[model samples]
Target chain A: MNPRLVFKAALVCLLLVLLAEGVLTLAKRHAPFFRLFQNQIVSCEILDDLAACSLKSGRPLIVVMGDSVVYGSDLHAHGVPHWREQALAAGLQRQLPQATVLDLSLDGALPGDYLGLYAAARRLKPDWIIFEYNYRMFSQKFGSPSEAVSRPWLRGLMSQPLFPALPQTAGDKIKSVLRKVSQLYRYAEAFRDAFFFPSREEVINRLLAQVLPSRSLRDPGDREMLLKLKIKPHYYTPLLTPEHAGLQAVQLLENELRRDQQPHLAFFTPQNQEYITEIADPHTWPRNLAILDSILGSLADQKRFFYWNWGALYPADAFYDHCHLVPRYNETFAKMLAGIIADGGRRDHVQRLE
Target chain B: MFNGWNENIRAFLLGLAFFLLLILILIFGQDLSSSKFIYVDF
Candidate 1:
């Protein structure tokens, strides 16, 4: 509480912090390559992968946007984890061969987050964009884009339409600005998750699984999980109201695409029909889907826009958990996507399967 | 009157502790503190 002591301590802390920041900046510059794990890629640092990725001739750039569905979440069930070589972008790469596929997806990405992601991705000048429309985005549990962490991702482009909600506080805006200023602040997690002990969580869980009882262990066999695992309450339960944030975010994205003439394919992300039909709320799921269809069906300007419902393409076994696919299925999904693109993503090529 | 460094090692230790704490938060704890509202079960 002494004024002299407080002043001295404050000055010392500031000087030390500045010194550490300088050291981190130097370390980053000399490091061969800074790799960001898929989970570590929060918000628009999706650009981190693109910046590190080897650029080809830049003929056809396919930009993928979605959540864990594209991230290959439960691929580990078959002794195969979400390795980029085995994931969707890799599959798409093999399918197209010449094209560059950028898979910019996080585990919990929502519809609101994509505006900033797309705004950031524009710098890459993508030729075709494939966005996965997960029905979970409609859940009220999540905030709209502008109100979320994406405020920083959008950067100076605040004047753009669709971002009506302001940040939670002035402190948030300042923190975001600071994040932009310091790479050390922004990518510290990327450094940890990528360089050191990437599997710290995995190792701990494995140890517990060995000593713990089967019931306590998180692992349930696939068949058992299929029978028991219920979809989280957030799935397909967006309240149908005048200010439905999820649907509104999608509409705003559609408006952006329409205005920019950005060729895009927005599809209903593939769902495990058997799991949904067996476990999830049957009435709410379909009802909300019908509501979604009506909204998309009514959206203006269909030119340069393609919406396909591939929701039921996979059966029970294709899924690892709720909505995530087993690794091999990612390759199969890639072929289907390749066919669509190879056929020029034509309206006739996209069939709406109920 | 500006003899604050008379505390010497105490001042240095306080500064060092604060630096490590800041660095730790910047790396692992940044996501925890900032995105508490954003749910990520992964």
Candidate 2:
């Protein structure tokens, strides 16, 4: 019960927490322990470096960016025929044999992140840039693009507006301090993810699913399984009004590309219509699509870039979930995209001749 | 008699115990269901 004993105990606890956090950080980077969860954990930095290297290769480079759909989450555990690799194998490379395709997509990436990525990627002078425009990200407001890659504490602090009108209560201020200072508090999500490791059977199933050709087939069971996954309906919320920050970021991205005379394509990626219809209110579904189309259409018209709304292009069977395409459809989607790009290039060439 | 030194020791012990309990809960009692890696919303 001595004060010195109490002080010693507190110091020991702090040191233990710090040591555990350090180990977790190292595991995140080097340890093979986390590789089992690769389906969920994406290394954005590695993807960025790969894209940058591809860009600098002096070949005509095509950079693709977006959220999980573009990250090919639906192709989880499947080793061969990744969307990017299939795009190349599906004659995308052969069509433009001198060009290279680099996918810079990551899970949860937004327009703000895309803006920052474009800024970084443009320096490498890619011939064409394609960004998947998921309507959901456009509806949500975003923090600063530059801070997206900063350290957790700095990112959380810098993401806040410089001059906030509302005064913070003492409790709010205390929580903020804890969030910034406590490694345990800041990396709670990471810890949770690490703790919930998938079983070996599940991991094996995912891997086998990747290799087995029948696994990609459009089964009636897919609908029930997808429904069981609890795909949230909130994503279909009709942004009756546009989010200014998102629009501005998209506008800025378009303006920069046009100024640099770079060819860019913004494609409205497909979503599972069956899932959307089942989950979303009938009125909200069409309204949301219209609102998204209007924004992308206006941007394309204003910036003189190509914007194609392919949201309903693929059937519900083409998707494993509400958003991502099944691995079987990757080649088809790639060929469709290549056709568009190739056709666009021929049209531009003809226009130049005129 | 509970003097100032005794009182300070009691408060310090209570604080230390509380923090240790919290750290233990975080380390062992994490919700396994809360580990979906991708944020579906954004």
Compared with the true structure, what per-residue lDDT tens digits does model 1 show for residues A255-352? 77777778887878788786666555666788878777777766633455677777887777777755777776788888888888877776554433
DockQ comparisons of all candidates to the true complex: 0.30, 0.10
CAPRI docking class of candidate 2: incorrect
Cα deviation in Å at residue A275, candidate 1? 1.4
lDDT of each: 0.63, 0.56
TM-score of chain A of each: 0.77, 0.59
TM-scores of the models, in the given order?
0.77, 0.56
Predicted structure with the largest TM-score when compared to the true one: 1
lDDT for A55 (candidate 2): 53
Candidate 1, CAPRI quality class derived from DockQ? acceptable
> lDDT score, residue A112, model 1?
66
lDDT of 2 by residue, A88-109 (tens): 2333455566677655565556
TM-score of 1: 0.77
Scored by DockQ, the top model is 1
